[model samples]
Target: MKLVVQVKLLPSPEQAVALEATLHACNRAADRASAAAFESGLFSRNDLQKLVYAELKADFGLGAQPVVRTLKKVVDAYTALRAAIRAGTLGRPGCVRRVKAESKPITFRLDAAQPFDDRILSWQHDASTVSIWTTAGRMKHVPFRGNADQLKTLREHRKGETDLVHRNGKWFLVATCEVPEAEQYEPVDWLGVDRGIVNLATTSDGHNHCGRRLGRYRRWQARKRAELQAKNTRSARRRAKRRTKREQRHATHANHKISKEIVAVAQRTGRGIALERLDGIRDRVRPSRDQRAALSSWPFHQLGEHIAYKAQRAGVPLIEVDAAYTSQMCPRCGHTARHNRPTRDSFSCRRCGLAGPADVVAGVNVRNRARSAWVFVNTPVPQGI
Candidate 1:
């Protein structure tokens, strides 16, 4: 499993200034490389390296690795733009934004051959600090702290490149760690999980994690956001942005908690998990304006992603099945009709007279699908969200 643990850095004022200057120098180089790449119509890393490597190194007084990393960022942006254009997701290739020294994340690309074995960037075991390479041609030990779980991972499983991020007057090191995959568990039965806007998640065992509180929070945020926009003042805008970030954090934390609960349920019951295939759901449905915001704001995809990784980390079997009629189909008698779900939150099978929470019915149907497909594909495969 791959996860990023964010460790907060505590740098002295002088050290902070040096870090900021370095960030500015790197971003300036990146912007120059971006302009060159787009104007020359050459986006390959090698080509970009040839174009700006020496100039950026001498002009910005940057190291060879930082120059290469900066140019690669430009190359990656153009590459993604070209791909999106070709895939018809975008009409045309767009201009890459100039990296702002104040806001852009400064990535320290550690060489793969060297790995992160504490040479360029290493942890000081005694000081609870990290020695990071800077543009000043010296390594500075910056004290850092994090939550117990994050610190534990840094002490034990730190690996790969770390990104230095400056946000709201704080420095953070986002470090990615590679952990061994969990041992696979034999499945006893299938656990169906239905994700919806009304209820964040519904399990086949008749559990509903409702979203009323989230909905109210969103509505409140929307109103405050509108008010802030009306003010059009700098402070109001800043406040609005901060509120939005807070709301996002709340939602993300809620998702993690909900996913943890679902995984725990599956683990305790000794069952695999089955979820709806939700790819491209947003584009597939057209809702009224009144309903659109709620639907669009729904975190079904996020919930699914969280559940997937957590389930994988716990060695719980998980699979996605087609979601054609899982919502309306009768889990008890195999009856399928839109009228089965006459209301948004209620479901009744006209044929079998079986009725219950609409989400639970959907959950049951998903479980049935998993049971039917168990013979073909039995184990969970960890994949990207």
Candidate 2:
């Protein structure tokens, strides 16, 4: 399993400015490379990287290593942009073009041997200071500090796939890890999950996961945002930055807890979990401002990811089914009719007069669909009884 570990970067003022400049330059180069590729029929990522790396070295007077590193960064961004385009996520091509124009000059990537990694000592909790290894040698340990709770997060980077990023005047580490493929298991029972804005999630088995806890945090965030907006002073802006960081930390902690609960529940049940293919839930939901805020705050994708990884680890299966008519279908009669689901909260079948909670009905439908598919696929049944 590939995992990423992220730790804080303690760059000196001069180094920080230099790094920012490099990043901006790399972003600009990537934009140019992407545009060139789009215009020229031969715009493979390699071609773009080669072109940009040479340009940075000759035109910008960057060293060979930095030039190569920056080109890699540009390639990464290009990959992300292309993916967004392929996914139909880049709504405005013009916007992408414009962003690319500004991006080429602003962002860059660092090599694994870059001075950034040499300073830190394997990222331990007890060590209060870690140095960034630079070409000049190990930088002095800057008195870096974070809350004790963050220590737990440091240990999560088991696979060391974390990325170090400098953005918007701050440094951040992001970890990306792949969930291992699950072992073959017998498919007998399935648990369906219904994720939403209001309640967060409702399992097919009559369990409800509430978003009210996140709602409370949202309210607090709103207050903080308003407070920041009210003040135009530099001090207020600085304070706002600190507030934003604090809120992000708290939100991440909450998500970790919620995700852990979801995985725990799935593991304990020892059954496959079924979820809707929520590829475009944002557009489908078209929620109100308050609703959207709450929905955005909740980490539905993260929860799903957690469930998938944990289930895989525990040898449980996870199924993704079409959500189109799951909410409307009558679980009793398997009838796909609009009249059966008269309201958002309640499902009543017009043909059979079946009544039940809309979410519960949807969950049952999801479970049934997944089970039917599993049986049709003839996936191996788990051993034992």
Candidate 3:
């Protein structure tokens, strides 16, 4: 399994300034390339690379090597950004368009391919400090007095992180690591997953996972955002930037946790996962204004992506069945009717007089779908349903 682990980069003041400048230039180059691709009707990576490389060398007079690295990194951003846009995974294009309009003037990408060295620790821990090395020469360290759990996590998982930045002020690191696929165990009789607005997810097999706790943190963030909007002051802006960083960190943590839980459940049961195919969920979810404010704060698509990757790594097939009537279906009698789901939490089948918690019923329906698919496909049944 491919997983990314991101640790902070600690650079000297001079190096930090250079890194910031490089990121700024890279963003501008990316913006220009995106515009050029949209205009020319040739929106491929090769086209983007050509546009960014030419613009960097001719317009900016950067060296060919640096220009090449910058172009490569920008292209990676472009690929991710464009995919989000095409999949309707991001908000409107206004912010990106605005960035393109105001171009920045440095750029960098990795200039040389280097072999992985095991001696280089991804993260290091002393009595009261933790450090992570990005390259052989650059390392970032954070101070924490005493946290054994954190130290253990840092030691075991630090190597998976890679830093990537979009602009000067906006920086992020992608953390991932490869895990060997688990051997197939006893065939699974069933797997059940529950997805909802409040809790995010719970499994019938006694595992619970929260979706995005960032929504809770947003209450504290709202004040900072308001202050920034009112005064347009430097401190307020910095606070706003910090809040955004916190939100991203929270999101990454949530994704890692959810992915880990899902993979664990699949491995333990040796069962195919059953999840609702929540297509067009954003459109369907109708929350009150306050609820919408909280709901929209989380990244559901990112969670789904984590599950997909981890499931693939574990050799666990994840089935995305139609969720149209799962919530209303009577798992005991196979009675599916709209009126049976009169409330969000309660499911009462009128035909069979079978009733249960709405989420549980839905989860059972999902498991049944997976089992039925296996049966139809003539896959060997797992022992003990």
Highest lDDT against the true fold, candidate: 1
> In model 2, how large is the Cα lDDT of residue 61?
46
Clash pairs of candidate 3?
Answer: 3-176, 3-177, 4-175, 4-176, 5-160, 5-161, 5-175, 5-176, 6-161, 10-140
Better of 1 and 2 by TM-score: 1
Per-candidate Cα lDDT values, in order, are 0.81, 0.64, 0.61
Model 1 superposed RMSD (Cα): 6.0
Candidate 1 accuracy as TM-score: 0.86
lDDT of 2: 0.64
lDDT of 2 by residue, 153-236 (tens): 454433433344765566654544344555747655888888765566777887777777777876887898778879878988
Query: Which prediction has the highest TM-score against the true structure?
Result: 1
lDDT of 3 by residue, 118-196 (tens): 3332334453333332322344453333245434544555454344433344333333455556554444676777677
Superposed model 1: Cα runs more than 4 Å off: 92-119, 137-139, 233-239, 376-385
TM-score-superior candidate, 1 or 3 = 1
Candidate 2 least-lDDT 10 residues: 110-119
